[model samples]
Target: MPHLVLLYTPDLETDADIPSLCRALADTMLEQRDQAGKAVFPTGGTRVLAYPAAHCAVADGKGPYGFLYANLRMGSGRSEQVHKAVGDSLLQVLKRHLDALLQQRPIGITVQIDESQAQVYDAKHSSLHPLFNRPA
Candidate 1:
């Protein structure tokens, strides 16, 4: 699984365009693969979500500052290049999408990519894939 969680300040809600940002990040990971050209993260397994923080404290005091922190969690057995590509791709999307808001207010953006062991990862699901399948 490739899960991207974006934690952004509520002040950005007006201009952050969170939905589009999430889609961009998810598309990047779903379309790209590892150095060996293996699609470890399936399209259905790619997830990108956003959370707007109502209360936040930034380095530039508590006025009009904002922050966007992203965490990308993936299963183990991925190449370092893959991790770097995913994180960098998402980070680029965040910066590019929020460029105007960032220029207006001091905003700090960061992204972290982490891996969890396959043994520790637990998954349970039903046969609902067909419902989400797209028509050709």
Candidate 2:
């Protein structure tokens, strides 16, 4: 299970095409492969969501600066290398997508990956996965 959530200031909404970013991130997740060349994230299990904070304050609360924070959560089974690779790829995409906006405004972008530990409780109920599992 891999879910990417993006939280950003409402001020950036006009310049940030969040829906487009979500599509890009979801596509990137589906492209990741393990060492065996198997998909790192199931096609039907990948999710990218973005939410704009209705009210917030940037650093020092003195400027028109904005911020975007990306957090990716996934089950723990992959090696550190895989995690790093995935994080790097995502950061690159985010940076590339916001390059133009960054040049025009003062904004902070952060990306982080979180892995659920073995002992953590997890549950899932979905009819979507079966659609992707159909026989080819």
Candidate 3:
């Protein structure tokens, strides 16, 4: 099975606690599984990891999106549809917690799905990380 890793910029919480975020991601992935007939790439049996960004701040922009940066990876190349789906799912979760986070800061989300076939050195990894060393 292919592995996917997700990374989000800016710490999830003011205090830097991501328990709730992680739980929500896990739930979202599982929920999408049965909601759709086919499995959702990356999100399907995918694992998420979130951490506090060393540099966390919202950019001056106009929109309902925040200046957030997210990264996603899959063994297969990422498609526009896939990015939209994953981004939508993540936006939903962020919206749910918008009250506590800067939800409308023109979030800069970047998702990169792998194109090369599965490799032997490709070990499974999580998306969330401290900052620089997260998913691709």
Q: All candidates: CA RMSD in angstroms?
A: 2.7, 1.2, 8.9
Question: Which digits, one per residue and each the tens of the lDDT, describe model 2 over residues 90-130?
Answer: 99998899999889878898999998886556788999999
Cα lDDT of candidate 1 equals 0.80
lDDT of 3 by residue, 77-112 (tens): 545575566657866775565445553343454444
TM-score for each candidate, following the candidate numbering:
0.85, 0.94, 0.51
* Model 3, position 68: C-alpha lDDT score: 39
Point out the higher-scoring one by TM-score: 2 or 3: 2
lDDT of each: 0.80, 0.90, 0.51
Model 3 TM-score relative to the real fold:
0.51
The lDDT, on a scale of 0 to 1, for candidate 2 is 0.90
Top lDDT hit: 2
Question: Candidate 1: which stretches are off by over 4 Å?
Answer: 60-62, 118-121, 126-136
> Candidate 1 has which clashing residue pairs, if any?
none
User: What does candidate 3 score in Cα RMSD to the true structure?
Assistant: 8.9
Q: In model 2, where is the ten-residue run with the lowest total lDDT? A: 115-124
| lDDT ranking, best first | 2, 1, 3
Could you tell me the lDDT of residue 114 within candidate 2? Answer: 93
